[model samples]
Target: MQSAFEKSISPLGLSFRIWGITQLVFSTLVTALLMQVDVLPDITVVYYVPLISAFLGLPAWLILRIALGLLASSRLNVRSRLDRLRWVIVVLGCGYGLAAGLVLVVLWQQSVTGFLTGFALLNAAFFIGCITQHSVIMAYFHVKPHPTAEARPTPAAIHQEQNRTLKKSYMEQTNKVLYKAIITALLILLLLIPSVFIQNLVQERKSRQAEVVHEVSSRWAAGQTLSGFYLYLPYVVSGTTDSGKPYRIEKQLIVLPEEANVQSVMEPEVRPRSIYKVLLYKSRNVFRGQFRIAPQGDFNLSLVKWQDARLCLNISDIKGIEEKVLVKLQDQQYEMQPGTPETGFGNSGLSLPLASVAEVINGPVSFESVLRLKGSEQLHFLPLAGNSIFTISSPWPSPSFDGSYLPGTREVSDSGFQAKWSFSKANLPFNTYLSDTKFDAGKFGFGITMVQPADQYAKTERSVKYAILVIGLTFSLFFIMEQILKKPVHPVQYVLIGLALTIFYTLLLSISEFLFFDWAYLIAATATIVLITWYVRGHFKSFRTAALLGAVITMLYGFIFVLVRLEDTALLIGSIGLFLILGLAMYGSRKVNWYGNEQQQDQPRLASTE
Candidate 1:
């Protein structure tokens, strides 16, 4: 038996060196890809930053190296040296494990499940490396040594020794070839890391799309928010000074209507600007409301100059008004002026001066108005009355109801949509009376957003988010094929395959601009699958392997499409999908002799000597 110091030197030193070099190259590539996401054009989506996955590769490489070292030292039969080396491996492995755990904690702060998935993959790599290294070492130890001079007297014994040496040489050659294939496969996986930059490219393109939308919206009319027809009453409060002198102060009182109602019909049109399209609409609206003044018993009306009261309607964008607004107060019609009575009412609106206040002070006052407005994207309303009711109908198929309140009743179809909203002071934060303060009426009401059902850029961004998984799985599939077939695949071929995968996104993004998202995905995925299948068939010279790969690609693309469309259930579906994929991989590789079958085949030759 060899002493511990004698057997300490690993027979697979060259293999470990190759693995280390490959790991270094992979680390560099992963780091470069991670940096690319930071430089991508600014877009906000809660996505797993590919950088987290990239950093995990570093610890994985370290753990693998330590595991290989441990396996190498395990060949020593002597107790003392083996014990010391084992402790060294334990320390190094623990340190690396702690570092990896810290990284996972940081990732957990950003996203819980992302961290869990990453940690699981990292541990899987480490354990797989441990198993592979241990098996190779065990196989090396099992090889029988040449016969000693004391046993080599007979001619038969000499021939048997020769045969044993030949078998050992063959096993060594086989091990070298297997190790080289593994290193090559790992290198191919490393090369696929750069494909993550394609996601950044997708984001940049999406940013440009947003810029175009903004340009178009700014040229037409931005989204409009119509606040109200509030009563603006200017008054004077008299007070006695400390010096016994009389003083009067000017003030304005803003009173909301007791009840208000609005009816609007919007005609929507799609305007194309370059390759992007924006939603715009022309709205014809009718506003009717009633304002009632409390009697003397309810409150003091002595200071109110009711005659000086003016009816003001708040419009967000005066430029969007398509027709002249006319107001009818108490059966008397008055055309509204361009500016508001006081700065108390917003700047961009029209106001009508009342002729008398005696009737208004005595009882309830009624008013009506007609307005024709043109706006882009969205139409928002403010709940400025004690009880407000708004009804809207449009020929737009997609409407996103956005704001503090949702529509009480809504009906939508392929042809059109109709929505109604009801709000009261009880539900609102503020009371009916307001004065001298700037109020954000937008926060209190519902808005109708005329939206495009499929935003190609957004969908493309979503698709790009899954690039890492797609590339990783595809590479794993090819690696498994290489192992099973025992065929050598060049690193360059792997790069070409990864590039083909990366180009899928760019194709999807460009095609979706002209076609629907679903159709674009189909066309892009099919073209990519066919191209890869043909390329793989040519490389492997096997139709079965190529067909299987094509089917896998098809299934992956289909799975991702389903994930994107079903956003709410994506996590559940993705988790289950991943579990099934892992199960399939485990099952397929169950019979693989990771240690090489040459050791088992040569076992009988050694037994014959005994």
Candidate 2:
């Protein structure tokens, strides 16, 4: 029942392959089990741990296959050297794991219970590997060596003793790799503290800027919304009193325009507050429309109050009204005043009183109003008439069209922008005319918000979100460099490297406040890369490796910047980028042999003293 691959491989190869597979499966299953208890944070890393483990576990699997496969071959002194290597990896691995756990608790502000839980799971997996290695060793050294044969001392017998000593086991080498990986994972978690703090700092600065904007805008003139220009009508109604006595009550009716047209020319300005800035604008608006107040049976018209009737306009901020608002009805001038809108018969938010005009029961009466309004950030208008058309032009390059409807046509460029909107009575939800204060005009308004193209805090906060990816990958990059160049990197050096990586966010945040995000990112990334590259060169002593590390780090920073700019497709693109990076890591590490040092190939000729 042996397959082609199984039949072709030697018994030694089969055993090595089986042992390699066994460790990987056991580690994966144990990881899955521990995750059930909620040991890890329930965030993006919730998915990263398992995928990273599998990707990182592959090289260790290769090391296992090679280390254990040496069992059936290799000489006496080589076996002794192997024993030394095995012990070194185990001692170093366990020492680093416990030390990292301690650091996580003390310095990183993690709870002891959390550290212990993770440490326990790691130790459990390690112990299982130890047991399995013992079995593999036992399977090989099955027979009891002759006691006299050992005393007589043959080269073969000494070799057997060496193999037994090797049985103390280099399979622990897998644990060393996994432990380093776990340690790196811990360092990444340590980085989360700074990353989160940086994010908070970004948010704090953004809030401060917002407060400044609000304060300055309040003084200058806040955002503006214009609704109505509704024709007002008051009439008397007869009603029964509680004792059946007849009473006359006065009520108001509103007449919507039959056709409405608005034209606004906006002049935008910027006001600075300390380190913050806000956008404000002054606009000239012309509202012209026809009011069709035909005969209606809703109330008795014999008691109509023509002398008291007035037109009303809603301007959200009256302070923004820099000049007098005058209406021309049927070519007659009428000045307006402010009114208490909460009662009714005016703009729903802020009411404007117009000069009294007589009721027109014959046909459509044309009216026009000129308003000089001042406001900050935004200017919006409601289409309250049967037929509404809006035409707006501004010199501000970046305008955010927002609210209930978008412009029917828009043209935007650096020079300025022009937008137009047209709507019919059928397009609106409410009737052309309604009782006083009956309609919520704000529910259907559209206009422009002066939008700044570059916002540093928002971009910095988004970059901080990917802090783990940057730290983990940078540490991983250095770890790989260490393995490839035969340079031993201490766990402390990884901490320093991770610190440098996390500091990139702070650098980006502070610098971006003054500079554009792209430029700030460049400066920060370059500074960190140069500093770390120089430090790495000091430890690695090879110009090529350090430069290569710097290049990869630069690419990592660039990739993260791209992800930050993306809103809709960040997850998909980020996932694909991670997969590609992992593939590169695997490919780069394919030929690595942890135990196959120069001494292994040098195999000195020796006579056994045993």
| Cand. 2 Cα-lDDT | 0.70
lDDT of 2 by residue, 279-378 (tens): 8899999989988766666554465676665577877778788877787788877777776344233233333343234443446788888888899989
- Clashing residue pairs in candidate 2 are none
Predict model 1's lDDT versus the native.
0.69
Write out the backbone clash pairs for model 1.
none
Model 1: how far is 404 from its true place, Å? 0.7
- The 10-residue segment of model 1 with minimum total lDDT is 39-48
Name the runs in model 1 displaced over 4 angstroms. 1-195, 241-247, 295-302, 305-309, 341-347, 355-362, 598-607
Give the number of the best model, judged by lDDT: 2
Estimate the Cα RMSD of every predicted model relative to the unseen true structure: 7.9, 12.4
Error of 1 at 53 (Å): 19
